[model samples]
Target: MDERSQFLADAAAQRKERELNRVQTETTLKLQALARGYLARKKFVSAVRSTTSEKFSAFVDLEKSEKVLLSNDEVLKWSRLFLRILRLPDDNEVLALLVPDTSYFHWTPSRVISDIISTIPQSLMYISGNRVTENSLFLASNEHKPLISGQALNALFSILFKSVKNDENLLPIFISHVLTCPAIVVHLNKANLDNFLNSELFDRCLTYLRSSPELVESIEPQKTINLLGNVIHLGYLDEETVKNRIVDWTWVIGLVMAQCTEFAVRPGEQSSHNHWHPIFGHYRLPIDPKLWKKLGGGSSSEPTHTAELEKDIPPTLAAIVCQLYMTALSTMTNMKNEIIAGICREDRTLRQLWSYLVRWGNQGRYVSSSSTAPSPLNAALSLMSCPQSLHAAPLMLFADAAAIVISILDEEELYERAVPFALEELVHIARFCNYFCFRAVWTGYVDDRSSDHGLFASIHQLCMVLHVRDSRRSFVNDPKFWLAPDVKSSILMGEFEKKTPRGVLLMRRMSHLVSLKERMLLFRKFVSADKNSNESSATLITGLDEAGIDQDGVFKEFLELTIKKVFDPALNLFHSTAAGVLYPSATSSVHEDHLALFQFVGRILAKAVYEGIVVDVQLAPVLLAAVRFFIQILLDFVVCN
Candidate 1:
């Protein structure tokens, strides 16, 4: 019985092996047949090339001789088939026919020919037709899978690279037409894309792009900007490309800043509502597509100038530039010191930065979610009043990136250059701060504060700078604006300029940056006359005990008690770190009047600073750093939570 079983097994194994061999032989034969047919067509085309050229005055006439010339469908089919065959384990027969004896051709057709075929463009057109949505049928199609798979996609990029290499001017066309196509982009796996970006093909494209800004601007610059934005968004840039390849970081920064400022828009060119991208949300510019199209448009009598047209950045492009700038900031964070040194070492970039800030303050307008009540900071800073309210949300994308860059600049740099700029165009920094502060409170949630730390940290930095400077010397002799004399008008008109000390005036202006007008009154307690602040001292009155006048010891005791009560765990106002330093509780917004309490806590800290009292309480390590910008943490934490 064992011997019979062994014989059966041996027979079955031999049968299976023969079937595999037969299949392999058929595949090889099929490949050979395809190669032979392709070779014959190539030879026939070459033989008739001169005859066709002589007979036809135009290429269209030759195209009409369809049988002699490859059709678009045939080109695509043959290209895909050849690519598939090239990736097979044994394609020697196909290689022998296509490659010359002295020449070598690898995976891509670019290796075989100097020109790009119509297949790539045709495939891109087919793919782009579907618009690359989550529900896109093209993404799920099995028939198109081979064309977008690993080897095929690389070949397509290589074809593009070769075409652009043959003619550098073709770079813009490929960027706008080929790379932007959803079909081509959807196939690019991040891992593969990263490798391609590190290649000379990508380097060459970037070199040409950086060589002339006009080259990009002449075409649809937005398309080029979005392409770069997509690359940055993918986080494909490795340390090598970032450190060595990027020639002008300042130019890149300038390009983004240019897109964010305001431009001419006709009065009648209004949209029913402001548009937010369904995908990008509030992290981008709020201008809708209809409005974007109308931006540069004007009446026949009032023709738009080039200077005005330059400022009409498309809404999508504006959003992308914000995202692009933010991503670039994150990628280059490791080189923060280098950025600081660069800005400090050169005044040209510094001056540009200052100018951009001033322009944004003067021209840029944010869409607020609620009433269009002017921000007090706007009046204080002398920013242009924009009465239009077309969007349902506050625009913070530009403000967020600007805050990050400002935070990156060191205190010495800020003191030397930024301080002067801030003083000169008070509206610049005030408008910036107001944009950040006016964002609506994200209430009724337990959340991560990590994403918002950089922005709030920057505000804290600005606060520290203003506070320290004010303590050393007054900002100006006449701090108050004489226009609004009474307290009510001063607060209503956003002047807050009556008897307001410089530090107090700045602080009061910032406090008026709440989203709701009714909420502005909550800060009225802070809006008071410049009293004898030197003689001002706290007296802790204990029930059924003597009132203690705050001498140095009494003040220290009072501060310690106040801080302990404010940060008490049971109160749920603040959370303590491992080292007992206090930070705002992430879930504190669940409590009503949390914002008011935060304002109160801010006053207490300010008083402590005013009295030169160093409290025994420990604060968050970041807040207690060399630069002590600690104002925004409480409000931002509670409201943004």
Candidate 2:
């Protein structure tokens, strides 16, 4: 054959190989799903007659029943109830059915259903209770026990787990119930616990874990969190974990955090979100979630220690683990922060030491990714989540994150450094005064639950922080940043009392920066839309905040100065390039508070260029010149670009 022909054939062969590999993978995943359905405790088989269609084929099992329970018209679609059967059993001879509560991504489990049916040529039974609603099954029979023995069940669950790591909810209970063995709730040491990932050790732990299953509607959030924390702690977390688990970790960590978050909110807790329909018109996990903002009220009660964790684990490492959770974790930031602080005491400069956890200096973007991470956010409310131990360094970490942003803006690489983070995260965090020292003279207290804001609490924080941070403290000297309102009379301080002007400004800056920073988070929802476009956003706007500044004369004057000094032209210019990345809600952060937005930036620029560090006296003029120069270059580049 000619060389070109041979090359073409080889290419075709490679393509075929990849397709085959994908099909096989999908087949394996689907079988596991079917197996899980077959093993579910409540699953009942029905025999039906004359069922012949592509989705299902009638199988006659006359031994159990003479009549066919399923027929062609009665083909089954076991989607909803099947979710309860979380894992696939090891026995291949076990015929199965499945119904999954739809997930956002097909990759998780449901993605491969088609592959399984196409390859295995099996029945996709439509189930309603034990009856076959859609497909007629000719066979109907099941034993109380699976054919597999104890060892078989473990190996079966283990192999299925290797393919699917995150779906433990229904499986844990099933394993516990089916095995008639209580799950290993806790072990004595890390060695037996499998902290470091030695497969044999981990296998032992998993075997033990699979055995014990004392089920309860979440009773203790901390108690469950401690037991889980130990398993994660035993693993030697480093570059390898990151490299190997990027795709898997997204689900594993997501599931782990989700479970913890559930415990955090417990069933009836009044959540800080509007979506939570408080059962008795109250709350869930911890004292109505509606009151989450107030629950950890006094300053001293931060959730820092976990009884299950090895106390000897370096505080720095503990801090990194906790700080990664800085954005939100159900409990107020301080409660989380205190835990991190305890760990950070062991090592002060953990950020510098831990490069994997953070992005810095050059590999940064002007906008966060268009996609928002939901697991981390959802876990925020679930009491079952592993909450961050707010050790000391997060405060410092926030400072460092803020400093990096400030320095970059001065140097004109602000877009590069802050784009990836969407500055909104830092700004939202500023209200607490953990990262930046600045604050507005005005009180920055926003109502909690600001509308079931998913991960967007970070966004809400930005708008409110920037809205109030610029005025002199005397403006709101009625109290400070951390001050709790006293309906009856006067108030008192926690940790650091009597807030400062500088503190207020710094707080607001993050508020503003976070808004600009979060522009990139809206893209995921945009992409998630189906081609039919029924559920997508009506508009690209992240959010829109109607002007909430009802103050009369005083705030009006402030608005003018802000527009002239900050908001107009400059914000508008960046918005043109960035608006695509934001949803209306995110954009409304600025729209909500015009004066605060402008003044907050104006003050910071003024201070840095004039009062604070003087990177360049002609910073303003230099910026203008850079803009003009960029315009000229862009004009030329536009022709080609």
- Give the candidate number with the greatest lDDT: 1
Worst 10 residues of 2 by lDDT: 133-142
Task: Pick the TM-score winner.
Answer: 1
Q: Note the Cα lDDT for every prediction shown.
A: 0.43, 0.33
Candidate 1 segments whose C-alpha is farther than 4 A from its true place: 1-67, 70-93, 96-350, 353-468, 477-641
- For all predicted structures, in order, the TM-scores are 0.34, 0.24
What is the alpha-carbon lDDT of model 2 when measured against the actual structure?
Answer: 0.33
Off by over 4 Å in 2: 1-227, 233-251, 263-324, 327-335, 346-641
* Tens digits of per-residue lDDT for model 2, 1-641: 99999999999999999999999999999999989988663344222111222223332233443554344333334433454563556322343222121111223232233333322212321112113211121011011232334333333333232322333333343222222211221211233223224433333334434344223113243223333444344333333554454333222332333344443333344446523222212223343232233323311113334322214233344344434444223333325445445434433243343332233212322112335233222212221122232233333344433333332232122223543233344333334332212211222322222222322233333334333332211212323333322211111111112344323333333333322223223223333343337556576655554354642344444544543444244454223112222111225355567556545655654444332232221223223424434212222222222
Q: What does each candidate score in C-alpha RMSD?
A: 16.4, 29.1
